[model samples]
Target: MADWLSPAEWDALRLSLRVSFWATLVSLPFGLLVAHALARWRFPGHGLLNGLVHLPLVLPPVVTGYLLLLTFGRRGWVGQWLDQWFGIVFAFRWTGAVLAAAIMAFPLMVRAIRLSVEAVDPRLEQAAGTLGASGPWVWATVTLPLILPGVIAGAVLAFAKAMGEFGATITFVSNIPGQTQTLPSAIYSFLQVPGGEAPAARLVVISVVVAMSALVASEWLARRAMRRVQGR
Candidate 1:
């Protein structure tokens, strides 16, 4: 392992974790909102919103990345406004990497959350409302607890997806070593070089380990949450 990976490997590993965490955290609320909308609402644009949310699942990662660049690039519309107003730039920054990962992983998160939400008993919500709980209060106290397992599962899925994300991240953020070169991107770079094969292999192993650990943690959390909800 030492022969394969250098300090740069450690940096990439840490950055991947940071990016994945931020991506998952930032997207969770939105995922839950979308999941609730899909479960309980039937507005006119509902289908469109659902389709848009799942577009990343079917669209090529490169295409998604290009779209992000077009919309969030320095010269791009939203990108220009953000840069001018907030001094926030994502074109080639670590923030951009997080955005790309979040976008790509959003569908998985939404799907998991929506399934969980749909499985919830609306009758229980109605009872809570009848008992003087407001809609938001019922959701906060009742619905959320029931869906906690799914939320955890979705977050884990998103985190895993973010960790392995490469095409969208590279296109949106470009591959800047130590800044934006995540584990997958670093592996790609190593594979392109002659003596970099061993390092690439090491990174791949690390990625697998990280992904496995995340899965195990998520499963454990989901089970624990399920037990708690049941106990309640």
Candidate 2:
């Protein structure tokens, strides 16, 4: 496979993997927090919060990418401030691709974990609390353990989503080779030229393989987590 694929293809594949990994890892904590709050809390504007969290799912990918560009572009408000204060930039860069992928995948991650949290028995957590465990402790020992499988599922889903992310990533990062060009972007690039079908097909295959592998791994991990939680 190494000999079959050009260095550019390898770079795209590696960049895709890196972007997906970072996107999932960076968003996991936020996803967990949002899922827990949505499942357990009754704060004001709960419906609005839920809708906002899921807005990306319903929004057009191009629109999401545009919104991201406006918010995180070098000359944009938030982007300008971050760049000036923290030297952070997300425009036309690999980091921008990560941000785009994470945003695109966020809704799926939250939804999966939220559904899992909702399915858990609240009394189990309440009992832990009544035993003098603090909120954080109860969540750590009981709530999190019960939701481990869900967390795994959510992360895997997000990773897969990130891997296939194209529209938003291209819009936000402009698909620079060896930098921001990810697998989907690479495939799209290859398809634009004459005689590019073969390379594009190769990338499509890699995408499929990666996605399937992630799903299988998620299932295995979830099952193992459940067994451990069940003390079997």
Candidate 2 lDDT over 59-163, as tens digits, reads: 888899999999999988999999999999999999999999999999999998998899889899889989999989998999899899899989999999999
Question: What is residue 140's positional error in candidate 1, in angstroms?
Answer: 1.0
Candidate 2 Cα outliers beyond 4 Å, as residue runs: none
Model 1, runs deviating above 4 Å: 1-4
TM-score of each: 0.96, 0.96
Whole-model Cα lDDT per candidate?
0.94, 0.93
| Residue pairs whose backbone atoms clash in candidate 2 | none
